[model samples]
Target: MFFIYRLFLIILLLFTAVTTVFSQGTTKEEKRTLKKARKFLANEKYQLAQANYLKLLTLNSKDVVYNFEGGLSYYFADFEQAKSVPLFESALENSKEDTIPELCYYLARAYHINGDFEKSKEAFTHFKPFIKTSTKSGQELMKQSDYYININDNGKKQLANKNENTIIKNLGTSINSTYGEYAPVMKKNEQVLLFTSRRENGTSKKVDTDLLPYEDIYVAKQVNDNWQLITDKVELEKYIPKDLNTKKHDAGVIYSSDGNTLYTYKNDLIWKSILENGKWSNLVELDKNINSSQYNIPSVNLSKDGNTIYFTTTRKDGFGGKDIYKSSKNEEGKWNVAENLGDKINTKFDEDAPFISDDGKTIYFSSKGHDGIGGYDIYKSELTDNGWGKAENMGIPINSALDDIYLIVDEKEKNGFFASNRDGGIGGIDIYSLCINCPTKIINTINGLLVDNIETPIDGTLTTQLLSSNNPAETTQSKAGKFSFVTATTGKHQITVEAQ
Candidate 1:
């Protein structure tokens, strides 16, 4: 009875994304199981995906689609690629029955990564023949990937050996799920983390792009060093409203240094949320000149000083798919119209997800236009006296054959996080932290609630003065009536709160 009831509920959710389009000869149970599995796969939740697929395989071990998708789920999860190799081989054997070119490709890539050179060569030989031929002799695929097979094979080797000094680890189930998580921004002293997800937290009832739920912001509080493990069927603790989230895509890019302002994505327009008296406000559309409403404004980052914003947009008049732009606050503390970062940073292909360093001189972002190993690779550039300098790929181990984006780092460049769907992760687009052996910043997390006499959150500015260091920090006001300060310097500190 319980299983039946659960299936009934899932079927309703499945209807939001999946149609009843089972191939003839499949039973009702098979259809349900397959849809559930596919939904999990689409959401990039590998554990559930692999589990559901294994259930379906019980009915038929050699089901080509099942094997292919199962292999994909495992391969993408990265945590289970060794076990998935056989699944890929199985998919390859039945590839003719199901049209899975990627089966051969992934199998070849897996063997290559595992150092099975002979087997990898054989697989790669088979994989390359499937590449679509070009009408003009040399022009095929992207010019950068003219030797896609060879370059990918070499790039895999580079990824295998590089970055041995950098320790990268998964954030576990608390902040990440089988669903996608990206664009991580942590609060003061890393006490809390905010990012975007397509998990069940979304209010939208429909499935996007066959498997994606509407993107929504998810917050996870860190208990010690780990995120709280999410229990099944329980409501997620952190979220925004339907107005800010909507049925369309939304994501968070950065939180102000003071920890009171959240810069986020709503309907592809960048919006900032103020936190005051423990409440978050509705996202007001930012400057019309920057948002443009006619174009998409996806990713954004704020300066350490909070006076400038670096963002990405796809305007009709843009160089291409997307371009990085910047807007500086005027003397009156309002944003001026955004200006493109220029040809040095923008390119013919897509460039987005800009992360400006604390000094505002170093910039990190992902771009396909810049020469890369494959797909989207994280790149870095410096703001020089002349202009934004030419971008360079972060290279091999840090990048992969697939999309790698939203790379962010801490003040010391010693530790931070980024989102990637790279093979061998626990799920689709998981968040991974990178530690580069830099000295850890010893810091304190200072928090307080600012409310008027009525105890309601009111517009205010909170400043902390470090007497020893002769330094000062300011915070933004949100409806939540709260303020926070993260400081590394040790000194007697005095606090002040003023309301307009």
Candidate 2:
């Protein structure tokens, strides 16, 4: 009996020692989890980190760090409504005096994100001085608060003004509101409009989640002046690799005249897609001759023949911001080296949204670099034998103080269309039309070296007739024996040269 009692005592002592060690290990794990949660929050992974922090809170209910981190996580996750009144309130209620200012700052941010402007202002007012004199983050928070206050005041006025008829309509319940819709490209027919949107129920929605709304290219046909959806929405996310599928932002697209070729801008690279058998093929990145790792291609325009490409980039040695550049296709069907349009066309400010005329003789673009009414204005320059001539403003009725972009012209119809966010539109931005009013007056001049068919120099009299249809408007003879005519309206005119 003595031996058995001694053995039992030894077993009891060993069990007690093991329990103590396990309890100590549990304490160490809680500490480690708390530290890791804080690190994740700092890196902006609020959701994952917040879950861990909340678990820690259950184990240690009075922990101030858990309350603070949980509130921040909710705020970053955009669940500001849930966080603002509860998580923030709890943190402020329990925070020590030394942490009051930080707690108040976070509470204000939560309120701000929740759209509770008045409450946010009150909290910021109390927290500003402490942040200014204390931490670096505090200083930044104060600056940010001041910026938000100003933005709020200005944004209200801007929003109110934007409701006027002069503003573009919000595309209403049909084309927008359900999703993020932007980057519209309209054909000259105006019957078909192509745009990009992040809408639901798209193919590859899972993969597209990395880009949110899964920004896809959508086409809508105009029926009775209203846009009607057609074709299955296409998401470019599948073309992207898993490692490059960013949850951030991507998308800007332009198509060739025939719509057989497509150029897309995503993740700082330019990709090309070919239309085959009525379907778009897999996208391939453009050759290095046109694309660079230094900067991204934001916009692009292709000439009528598809042999010339104009694009915008912020590569080094550029004028400023993003500059317009041109590259031509060689005989091998590869892009030649890119060439800047030079200082005449580019300025120390941003110049983008380039469109070459169908005739390929005139180029239209928007620029903040040139002296403008305000923001960006549309400008055009004709291609001369010596290169591009001086740019000319399209003038007041066409240009505005607000952003004007995506200029298009139909040479055959002599009509132009451009997008603007100016004082008149459906909302955001609206397309406008401008007519080319051809002049009526005609001028004729005849000047050329007088040479016979046999290449012999001879004195000659050149007679030119300015004709429209069957009737001749004017008949003129060249005094210097050379021929040239300038007609107000474009038409077939007859000319006759006789040597004397």
Candidate 3:
């Protein structure tokens, strides 16, 4: 009887310990932190919420609510989406699906950004049945889920056969930071680069509705084949120009062919600044026809002759969210009403960051509605006799399972630049340069199976000698009847096997 009582006490102690580890006490400081975190999350301040939840998670890693909310915080923060997958997984493991019905959708999004399309599809499938189509929000959720599933399928196909011939490389730390850097536009000579960033060094440390720092324009100049940030006060003032960057949001749209006129987006309106006498003039808002009071214009590009302007907007009359529109100047040089690019190039989702080629026959933009892999993918549509051709996705290595926007190619098309939030970047979104039609130097590998005439496994030494003159030969001993060699040159190589 005494042993039984002692055993009960042991069990009770174990239960208490487990509970203590998995849950936080009502301490005033912890309670305050939890309250602040929840408030920030509800208010869509994801970055701040993420910081607070990180503290709570450290204190109680096994709490279901903490894990789920923490997952959402990271998920919506947009930069480190991969960090959400494990937290969502933990939440789902500790709770019932019905109790956390929204978990699957977010988990799928996290998976999609991480390039795990198969898992993402499964999570989306699990989420579909929970959405009730009767309600408007529910119907929207259903549609969003279906959209993700379709794009996930596309992601799987495109990522499996990524473009190997194209070389895409990050622009390095000088041109990027740990914050979001996007919407890159370059001068015709490719000597100067102007991009938008939310880095901490902006004019004012103020945050926008999403709790991210307000956008600011930054400039970098090429030095010895590498980009260097223009940091000298005199150089920065010269390149940035007064009033070009403000405490409020400011972003780069495109640079004119002459590099004298700069089109920009400020507070959802299209504006332009002219470079005269080595200084940029104050921004002038575009014509009323181009700057609609009812919608936001995120991007714009000009015809070579500066007669027509292509811009992106989300007016209610648009095909859906944002769509590309063009406005041509009248005989009096006044802007005319805009015309939508039509169903061929626009969709029910967003289309933004249009860049018209110098020829004005082809335009490149970013879209989320088309047959995309994930997030927003860059696409190009060429104008034909029939109208704009169906936009073609710019395919992998140029576009990843993350937002890739604002692509601009040199007149020769030999090199191009864009921005993406794909993994392995130094920030949420970093500028990247692509070598167009450049030769790819790939190392080829040779593998051989060593076996006796009876087909039994045999130990052997494999030797590989390059056909090129004066190159050293390499040898590898077989391991379990297998041997391999890597060739550095494209030239033919000879392989000889010796049985042991």
Top candidate (lDDT) = 3
TM-score of each: 0.64, 0.48, 0.76
List, residue by residue over 61-142, the lDDT tens digit for candidate 3: 8778789889988776645667788899998788743444566777888899888999999999987877666667666677
> Each prediction's Cα lDDT score?
0.67, 0.59, 0.77
| Residue 29, candidate 3: alpha-carbon lDDT | 85
Better of 1 and 3 by lDDT: 3
Clashes of each: 17, 18, 0
Superposed Cα deviation of residue 294, candidate 2 (Å): 1.2
The deviation in Å at residue 362 for candidate 1 is 0.6
TM-score of 3: 0.76
Which digits, one per residue and each the tens of the lDDT, describe model 2 over residues 320-406? 887999999999999999999988789877887888888898888888655454446678998988888887766555565455676
Off by over 4 Å in 1: 1-147, 150-157, 229-248, 276-279, 438-500
How would the candidate models be sorted by lDDT, starting from the highest?
Answer: 3, 1, 2
Q: What is the lDDT of residue 332 in candidate 3?
A: 95
